[model samples]
Target: MERMRIAVAGASGLIGSALVRSLTSDGHEVRRLVRHEPRSADEVRWDPEKGRLDPAGLAGCEVVVNLAGAGVGDRRWTDEYKRRIHDSRVHGTAALATALASLDPAPRVFVNGSAMGLYGETGDRIVDEDSPAGTGFLPELCVEWEAAAAPARDAGVRTVLTRTGLVVARGGGAWGKLFPLFSAGLGGRMGDGRQYWSYIALHDEVAAIRHLIDRDDLSGPFNLTAPEPLTNREITAAMGRVLHRPTLFPVPAPVLRTVLGEMAGDVLGSARVVPRRLLESGFVFAFPGIEDAIRAA
Candidate 1:
């Protein structure tokens, strides 16, 4: 594959940082979109809230990836925080998409970040890229979030919405919180533990993003999850096994609700998502199972 100039928003995030490292290591030029003044030649200043970005800074980029969004599970979901989550994704995506569209020579591809929460609670039913959007705050938010990228698609860019799942990594994300608890033997199943979790290793997550960047024939939503979806109970057992810890306790759904408020619904909800599109596209996973993913983390 030939190296190309790529610009990434949210370059400081877990997946974003990993992507930048991967791209640069492969000899591709990477420009980071930052909110502050450019700290280096590779960084470009862009204020997403104000919908501002210098077109000249993005001129030579062949691909633009947008992963800019507020952390969903960072805090209690207050009305204020909910709005922050919504605006951060919708407005930020719109800002980037519009800017990409306005470029004299727009990027060939635009990979937008989305989440599996778009499917809401699927219980035991399997969902794929073609699945209809489910009900709930997250589903509604993701609907608008993906829709916000229409500008890039309308501009003839091969836009793709990556509906990522639980990314297992020791550094950050949900696994960052879980690894400590499991290591200390405090980890347990959330709620009844029947809820399914679609997970992927951080390495595989970055690999999938890179795969998307290279595949010119792919477009629209692609589920970035492991093929074998595991239940919360199975995941707890796997973590305990990997860490040589005990997984005997169970956090009741009520307590989760009391502690996490609205966010608890997502924790307890079941989403049996699969990477049907990715599999069909010939993209393979390095850590496709809970045990392997936990061990990798």
Candidate 2:
């Protein structure tokens, strides 16, 4: 792959940080769009909430990857926090997209972040990139989040909406919370354990993003998940098997709702998403099976 200058928003985030390391290791120049004052030569200041970013900062970049957004599972979804979640994604994406679109020689591609929560509760039904957007807070939020990137797309940039699933990683995301619990032998199935979870290993998540960046022909929504979808029960078993612990207990739905508030619904919701487009595009996953993903995490 040819080395090129790339600008990344959310460079400090879990996925973003991983991507930055990957891009730099590949000999690409990385410019980080930060909220605070630039602390280094590679850093540039931008406030997504205020719709402010330096257009000149992105002048020579070949690609712009927007992974800026508030984490959904970071806190209880109070009305205010809910608004923050929505605004962080929608507004941040809009700010970056608009800025990128206005550049004299716009970047060749704009890889925007999205999530599988757009499918909402699909029960046992299989969903793909072609599936219709499901209803509910997350789905609605995702719709607007993707729509905010319209400017870049409209500007003729090859914009790719990466609809990511639960990223299994030891350092961050849901797996970060799960590792300790399971290690302590307290981890068990969530709710009824029948809810399907579409997931990808952290390794594959970064690799897939890089694949999207390289494959200029691929655009629009692409589901970033392992081909095989597993139920919560299966996931629990896999973790237990990997850790040599017992998967005997199951958390009830009501308790989860009581504890996590509105976030519990997402926890118990089923989304059997598949990576049809990615498969067709010849992107092979490093860890496709649940056991492999859990072990990697």
Candidate 3:
């Protein structure tokens, strides 16, 4: 638990930035790995597509948190953008894994990013780390992304793939996207709103990453989500209550299907993921449920 050297890729991202802040607060020496020249004092550079990186930046580090990848929801899944999504994850992961493997003094631990989408549409089933992977575009992407990190594991580094869920924060992440319409009484169920929506708060997501770092016994995929999962309607209702608003305007299923196309699977499909491994590992959630999380955040 002494001061540890940590290098975080995609340090500017929602999760990565939080990890940097948390590690620094915990008295860890944290360094940021950026895609471009960081116009500041605290950054190292890397270009994944070009297969370039300064592995020296990762040297002497005890932990390497890989949070790099294109924003999954940042763009509509056009044919080209879909390719970008897949490439951003697989290529970036490959570059980092390869870089880490070739380093003389490589990291002892690698916390790579994955997603609950790896389980695909599970309907009402509760999935855990040991559950078999599902079949879908998202699942395929997650599989490849994690596979790209195999070299690091082979190099004797402790590796964990965080199969994360919807991360909700008041001013950021998925909650920020839905708050406006719901708070304005213009938001309602999407499709039937019966589809499950597994989620975690920004606070717990950050804390869980740190917990993973501290728990040396953990490896492989761990579901980074709250123990209590909810349906879309359930989440919407909780948000509306927190904001003192009414969610009366339903987004028709046809509209979503039309706009999202194959991507609509993300919104329509169900994923009731559970943090079973983390829970069994004696990890406790700061926000175990939607109501408590919304109020605290």
Candidate 4:
């Protein structure tokens, strides 16, 4: 890819921050869309919640990536927090898409963030990018989230929706919370442990995003997950093997329900999602299996 101007929303986040670093390291001119007042030449100001964004801020950028959203696992699923999760992604994405559409020579690509939760509980059924969305709160949220990018797509800009899975990483994310507990021998399966968990290493997640940005023919939703999906029990075993700890503890479904409330269903639910489109696009995974992803983290 040639050196180009790129703008990224949510540039301070786990994947976003890493992407900015990767693009900058390659000598791309990276502009960060910040909510606060611009503090430097590289920072542009925008407030997605309030539907605030200046089209000029993203002018001349060949590509724009939107990853801003409230963390789903950040807090217990209170009604208010759930609203934040939905609005943050839907509204923020709409704002960015509209701004991109307004550009005179709109960006060549718009890569927006989504999640695998769109499939809901697959109960061991293999799902891919073309699978119909399952019924549930998470699934409905994802539908709206991806639809929010219509402005950019409708304006003739190539738009790519990345339905990312659980990112295996040492940094912040659901997987980040697992290392300490598993290393301390306190980690265990969330429920029956039969539920499938589709995951990709943080390295592959970032690389896949870059791959989408570089491909002119790729658009629509692509599952950003590894080719293989493993069950929670298998993942727990991998964690124990990787950390050289005993996997003796097991948390029951009732216990998880009491602790995590509504979010517990997501923890225990199964979705055997795969990256059919990503692989077809020729994006390779650095950590393609459970054990490999665990070791990478």
Candidate 5:
């Protein structure tokens, strides 16, 4: 394996932390761009909201991965919160791309974090990187989110936008928020629960990212999901089965619409996305099945 110098923004977050661990443990030089003064050698300081980063700190880094963003489900989707979500991603991305473009020794690869929401609610359609981007708030966000990375791309960086799926892990993301409710027997299918849930185990999620980073031929929007896409009802039932609990509680569509508003579409709609490129690139999944993922998580 080629040892390289890497820098990751949002290293405190779940996926970012996992990537940092994986990169550093593999004998690569990994540095984290943090919001506060870094306490270690492998850390740099940057404030995305203020559009500030240490250009000098980024020197000699060959790979830069931007994972900074406002959490989508962290709060109710008020207009202000929505704007915050959009601005956070756009501004952070713009700042990084601009910084990288100005560098004399620029990073060769820039992995930009996007979401499967870029495809909107495609029902049963299996969209890939070449598919036309859909319309809707999320799709719009992704469109702009990706546009913000143009500066780096124009600077000759090999840019990759990971249109990621629901990442199931131990502490956070979709599974973390849902696990407690399911374990307490309060979990159930929301709405019709027929929408496809294109989810990936966190292990594969991180591994595929590392794979993309190492592969120079891979670029553009890559759907980072599993081979199998399960429905909401299926995921709920699987969780119950894993814990030997019953999942029968139901959240009506009306209630979801009222609570999540525009987000209701994402919460209830489907994105049966497939990683066409990952399979083509010969990457293997560590936990391909949700049952194995839930049990192991």
Candidate 6:
């Protein structure tokens, strides 16, 4: 593999941190964009909210990946939190794209973070990169989020929008919450459990990102989900089978709405998303099955 200089925004995030480790361990020069003072030579200080990033910090970097964004599941979806979610992704993307555009010899690739929530509530209707954006806050947010990367694309950089799905991991994200609950025998499916969940194991998720970075011929939106998406009930059974727990309890949709407010829709929503472009690009997933993903998680 050819080692390259890469700069990453949101270097502290769950996916970002993992991606940095993968890159650096492979002998690639990885520069981290941090909000605080640079703690080391590898760290660069930048304020995405203020639209400030020094091009000098990213000079000569062959690839720039912007995974910076507010965690969608970090808190309840209040109006304030919704705005934070929207602004963080848009501003961070805009900052990175604009900075890359201004570079005399800009980076060759720009991988901006996006989510499968772009196609909200698919309800078992399988969708791909060509699918139209669904109607809702999430869809709208994703539209704007992807649009913010226009500067890099217009500058002739190979731009990729990774429409990531639920990442099954041990320490953070949705799976993080699920692990503890299932371990304690308190885990169960939500609603009628018919909701389709398109997920990717964290391992595969990182691998997909690296694949995108390496593929010079590939650009545009790629759904970073496993090929076999399962329904919520099917996932519950798999979790039970993997973790050796009982999948008896089920959280009703009304109770979820009462507790999660606007966020309930996301949990109850069904998005049978497929990674058509990613697969076509020859990226392979290590954990394509929910059972294997749960085990990995």
Pairs that collide in candidate 3 are none
Task: Please identify which of the two predictions, 3 or 6, would achieve the higher lDDT against the true structure.
Answer: 6
Q: Residue by residue across 1-297, what tens digits does model 4's lDDT show?
A: 589999999899889999999999999999999989899999999887766889999999999999998898888999998988988899899999999999998899999999999999899799999999988789999999999999999999999999989889878888988888998999888788999999899889999999899879899999999998999999999999999999889999999899999998889999899999999888878889888888877
Clash pairs detected, candidate 5: none
TM-scores, all candidates, are 0.98, 0.98, 0.96, 0.98, 0.96, 0.98
lDDT of 2 by residue, 1-297 (tens): 788999999888889999999999989999999988888999989877667787888898999999988888899999999988888789889988898889989999999999999999999899998899999999999999999999999999999999999999888788888898998898899988999999999889999999999997999999999999999999999999999988777889999999999999989999999999999999999899999988887
- For every candidate structure, what is the RMSD over all alpha carbons to the true structure, in angstroms? 1.0, 0.9, 1.4, 0.9, 1.4, 0.9
How many Å off is the CA of 133 in candidate 6? 0.1
Per model, how many backbone clashes are there? 0, 0, 0, 0, 0, 0
Model 2 clashing residue pairs (backbone): none
- Model 5 over residues 54-136: C-alpha lDDT tens digits? 68889999999999998887778889999889988998899899999989878989999999988888898878877887898
User: 5 or 6: which has the higher lDDT?
Assistant: 6
What TM-score would you give candidate 2 relative to the actual structure?
0.98
Query: Model 1, 71-178: lDDT tens per residue?
Result: 998899999989889988898899888888999788999999999999999999999999999998999999999999999999899999999999999888889999
Instruction: Encode model 6's per-residue lDDT on 1-297: one tens digit a residue.
Output: 788999999888999999999998999999999989988999999887667888899999999999998899999998998988988899889989998999988899999999999999899799999999999999999999999999999999999999999999988988988889988889899999999999999999999999998889999999999998899899998888998989788999999999989999999999999999999888888999998888887
Worst 10 residues of 3 by lDDT: 169-178
Runs in model 3 deviating more than 4 A are none
Clashing pairs in 1: none
lDDT of each: 0.92, 0.92, 0.85, 0.91, 0.88, 0.92
Tens-digit lDDT track for model 3 on 1-297? Answer: 699988888787888878788889988998888777877656778875555777777778888888887777766888888888888788888888888898877787899999999999999888888888899789988998999999999998889999889888756566667777776788788899999999998889999998899888999899999997899999888988888988888788899889878877898889999999899999988789898888766
